[model samples]
Target: MSQFWSELVHNLDPYVPGEQPKVNNLIKLNTNENPYPPADSVLEAIRNATDDKLKLYPDPNADLLKQRIADYFSVQRNQVFVGNGSDEVLAHAFQALLKKDKPLLFPDITYSFYPVYCGLYGIDFQTIPLDEDFAINVNDYGDQGGAIIFPNPNAPTGRLLTLKEIEKLLINNQDKVVVVDEAYIDFGGQSAISLVNQYHNLLVIQTLSKSRSLAGLRVGYAIGHADLIDGLERVKNSFNSYPMDRLAIYGAVASFDNEEAFQQSCRAIINTRETLTDKLQSLGFKVIPSTANFVFASHPDFSAEQIAQKLREKAIIVRYFNKPRINEFLRITIGNNDENAALCTALSEIITS
Candidate 1:
């Protein structure tokens, strides 16, 4: 630790993102990215955005992009907030909405970013553990806290809580904000943004990276009551005036315009996820029912670490968390058909031999 570093930095346990390997021809299923490409319209729009206009600074408020998102979600302009990515949007929320005198509350096994955000902002937080089935129990969240946030179809586990359960949490805690990270809602679950109009305390954040296949562009947005959006905007303006660039804004707008194409891509991934789950189960792995673009599975005969190493030897990569209660499970993203076939083939040989 350097003497120049602040005490906060010394105590922080930074979030380690999934590795992005540089090897060629490797079947990468570690990160939950869409196997499909972005819509043609989105590509055309992005290409068009790469013009002399880029020399000019983008709209600091990102008004046009916000309007497009508002139109798509049927929310008002003031009710929508855009950021560099959902991660940044979530970071802003942790500081603006979750830093209270009381501790923030979230699932123990939820997004690793949540805890990292808490550490970054010096927010006191408490974790609510998921049930034995690896599903979120809404009833367990009846405690005093500053705010609450969790992925709907939670990460790694891919188990989802119903929209009614989310609304129940909002209803029970009317005074506090509840942020739902819907990055994977397009896969197998419904979005909680539908309830944002009814619940003033609800904030639903989504990313174009996963579902819309624009991870490289880095665009994400949040929908909520106008007041909550205003609070986030206040924090955002204080930090950076132009988090969304011109290309990102135009690309995000085009993504919303081609909603049908993106929906089709999501459907295909869901189908692949079903097939992948069945294949893993046939190989004696207990696969969780996934609503996200990935599957979480644990083998009866082999440990998660062993399987990950074997897959790596075959030029395939999947995520393995060396943590408790889930140390035996691997979070494998659903790749394209050929990629999935290769992964299954590699696993079959490893298991058989």
Candidate 2:
């Protein structure tokens, strides 16, 4: 904390993303990334894009990918905004819309990044408690000020709030922005993108990381009214004209193109998640009902840290949060069939022994 740094940097508490361990064959299940590989068409598109075209700059606006997302979501191109990843899209969003006269509102337990974003942007914010069962209560937001943002099927917990409940909040707070971070929407939750046309203040953020199996490519987008999209575009242009490189643009467009493959992958994850939930419950775990590609659960007989540590010793890894409200839970990403089998076997030994 010496030297002359920007006051913003000095005052920031950055978001720490889940670990991407370098160890191979560890049965990684911490990050909610898709366990399957991306569609072959996405690979081919990236390969085809890596050409003499490298000498030329990508469309500063990433027009092709924008058009693809626009068409897929039945929105005009002007109503869509793309970025290197949803995190960046969210950064642009915080700068563009969330800053307000009153403190922003979010769930006390949410995508840990929300508070970090607020700190980074110097935006005042407040947290509302999740219900006793950890579900979002839209009625509690009636006295709120400023904007609101939260993951649809909230991270770590994997519990989803219905679109109807989201609409209630939007209707109640019609004057302020409501940013629904739908990063996991494709897994099972209904998208608020469908309601964007009805609510001008709604901005639905999504990423290709989970459903498209393109976390490596880092492409994310937002769907909203033209005015809301334009605000993000202005902030993005001011920050980085080329948030997406050539390969990312091509690959993201291809991911949207292969809609069938994307749907198949998401369905597979959902199926595996259901089976895993049963296995965890049989092992005496209380698993949260998850609509995302992960499950949050814990055994009544064991500590969350112990479960995570035991799994690590077995060369399996999942996430364990030591924070409040849900400190006893473990967030396990739904892996492939074989990986899930390995996890189940590992948990059987770990829990019993």
Candidate 3:
């Protein structure tokens, strides 16, 4: 809208993030954030890091945090790349690996940011539609795109694809880069990070924001072949050398130190997600089988927009996308016990009324 804007800027369509309300009292389930708090050790580490060292710059390479992540994933330190968040890590991937002579390929119903990143980077792309059940069928990927990227338990839909299916995709498209965006893999689905070493072209991206309960800390990373990591590093260094700050680095390192707390939180969310799905099904909502922290469901008797609005009135918020093929569906994040109970109560009231 500005005269000073470049042609690329003028044509860009930005991604819309989930709303963060001004008030704190509302039950916020719109964004798929972890309901549990970060591990105690993570908080303690972050607090301990706030010292006179704040005056100096954080390590530009973030070697210690990279080493911790590498060790956790059973990969070499050279194969791990850390960034401000998975979003940033993904941005680097789109720029470094995905843009090519052929068009990029992704699921039609995927993280909306994929298309946005394509637009930002001027990368040509095509979308492979999910099946009637909102599940990805890897057979449809073919060998056409320059690269491939899709979420394991895909965003908003929460439908998961198995590692076998993923391996098949990798085999079919051996020549192209395949980026598995595992932003929600910890909820129930297995991570593709396990296969990164087997497939040199495979790049797995993950965020601490969801399962690790570090959305505020803003840490994410990628695991891949050392060459791919080096390519991402080239893009990252050209853009911003110091993506991870001191606190984020130390806190993320501590997150790995406490596996028990991390597993406990993931299990709790998975349990809540199943309970919420069953409750929605009983209330006449056609709930998709979700392996992520959120459930995607639609009530045949009511509009998704109406349900979202009514829940908003009750101080509860869930995501409702008015896009094609999924306009009637609502993506509801799994909250804590009390929050889930309140959400069920509100939905029950809405259904009965």
Could you give the C-alpha RMSD of every candidate to the true structure, in order shown?
0.9, 0.9, 0.7
TM-score-best of 2 and 3? 3
lDDT values for all models: 0.92, 0.91, 0.95
Residues 1-353 of candidate 2 have per-residue lDDT tens digits of: 85788777788888888999998979889998899999999999999999998898789999898899999999999999999899999998998999998999999988999999889888999999998777889888755678888899988788899999999999999999999999888888899999999999999999999988999999999999999999998998899888789999999989888978998999999999999999999999999899999999978999999989999998889998889878899999999999999999999998898
Model 3 ranges with Cα > 4 A deviation: none
In model 1, which runs have C-alpha deviations exceeding 4 angstroms? none
TM-score of 3: 0.99
Candidate 3 RMSD to the correct structure: 0.7
Q: Tens digit of lDDT per residue, candidate 3, span 158-246? A: 99999999999999888999999999999889899989989999999999999999999999999999999999999999999798899
Candidate number with greatest lDDT: 3
lDDT of 1 at 246: 94
Local distance difference test, candidate 1? 0.92
Q: Which stretches of candidate 2 lie over 4 Å from their true place?
A: none
Q: On a 0 to 100 scale, what is the lDDT of residue 294 in model 2?
A: 94
**How much is the lDDT of residue 202 in candidate 2?**
96
